[model samples]
Target: MDWNSFWEGSKDLSTFALAIRAIILYIALIIATRLMGHRQVGILSGHNYLVAAGIVSLAAIRMLNPESSLTSGIVIVFVYAFVNIFLSYLDIKWPKTIDRKPTILMKDGIIHRKNMLDCHVTIDNLLGQLRLKGAHNLSEIDTIVLEPYGKISVIKKPEALPLTRKQMNLPPKMVALPTILIYDGKIDEKNLHAIGLDHEWLMTKLREKGIANPKDIFLAMLESDGTVYISI
Candidate 1:
């Protein structure tokens, strides 16, 4: 082929390669974001928003830059991955710096108008999100927290009931949140300590439930009523 024809052919090949690279980069970013966690997409906080925006911007540049090589796109992907890992480490080591703390936007059923304004959230939007979460009335909401990730959490006050003993079908019992004793065939030591238990205590409890080993119990619960429920 003549030099002119050869050059033209190479340009066409580069275009095709760039198109493929763009598609791959786009899909990889989506997968990476998903793997990072669901919160990465739902909560657009400081670093999270930047990371998401940067990915889209870089992908566009890769597709548009005809001279951009495959290695350049790969480098961008690695850069994003490293940033995510570093941020996660910071979040673990110093939670206060990395994770956005929840702010009280509403207290005692009264809305903090200044806070709402600062967050760029209106009463209508707040009520809409709350209603979606099954909160029908503002009076029912005890506290509304504006999460760092631009999400609002509504906590409702305990419902009032008649003061008749006959109406109370069950005794006043405090229900403890269920703890994961074993996950993926491995014991969670942190959870054990949280529940004030040790390996020996768990083994003994397992034996009473006819579970030969901790692995035999898929899920176990220790209730405030001093009851142990085991699921295999």
Candidate 2:
């Protein structure tokens, strides 16, 4: 068996064979990803990210290019996936073994310049993340922690805390999270059931609001305060 010719089989395989090979590799890739349990793309840790990249590369190579040992390619993909899963388990049990400790970028309104430098977080990045957390002035912050995932958690100073109803001795009103009843002209039956509303009742309410059909509304949300908002 010529080692070079082994990988050169892609040129000789017919389109029908290529199609079958593509299907098998595609299924193998999907299964491997499912086993890894890493759903959100591009937000993975360094190890998991590498595993994902490797699996994709393997699938692409065997599916489009030379169909190397199809069985071996699939086994390699699953092996990488299992290794990733094991790493995640280890991280859960032994934390810093897989995840770096979160660094404090700011404390008591003072930015930790040295820690920021060590963590490779720039002054501009600090300010940007702060702005995203609704904080503009460093002096108004209590502590800002930078997570391993490149996200920041901001804590405002006690003095800068917003005044709530409790602070003013005002009566606290019950709050209910608004649920989407319809989105993009499609009714969410599950959400409607969770909200204790039926289809007939929704249709009746829509008609009362001069909407004959729920599909005519672009978005419809039900608030806890018995308010049904319809966006056309």
Pick the TM-score winner.
2
- Residue 137, candidate 2: C-alpha displacement in angstroms: 2.0
Worst 10 residues of 2 by lDDT: 1-10
- lDDT of candidate 2? 0.81
What C-alpha lDDT, on a 0 to 100 scale, does residue 16 get in candidate 1?
A: 53
TM-score of each: 0.57, 0.77
- What do the candidate models score in CA lDDT, each in turn? 0.72, 0.81
lDDT per residue for candidate 1 within 1-232, as digits (tens), equals 3333222223445445555666766777777776667646764457878877887787676667655554556677667867876786687698778887777889988999998888788878898888888887888878999887777788877672225444667666565776777764578899889878899988888888778877766777775666777778
lDDT of 2 by residue, 1-232 (tens): 3334343344666677667767877888888777777532544466776787788787877877754667778789888978888888887898788868889988777888899899988988889988988899887889999987788999998899899999999999889999999999899989999868899999998998999987789999998788999999
Clashing pairs in 1: none
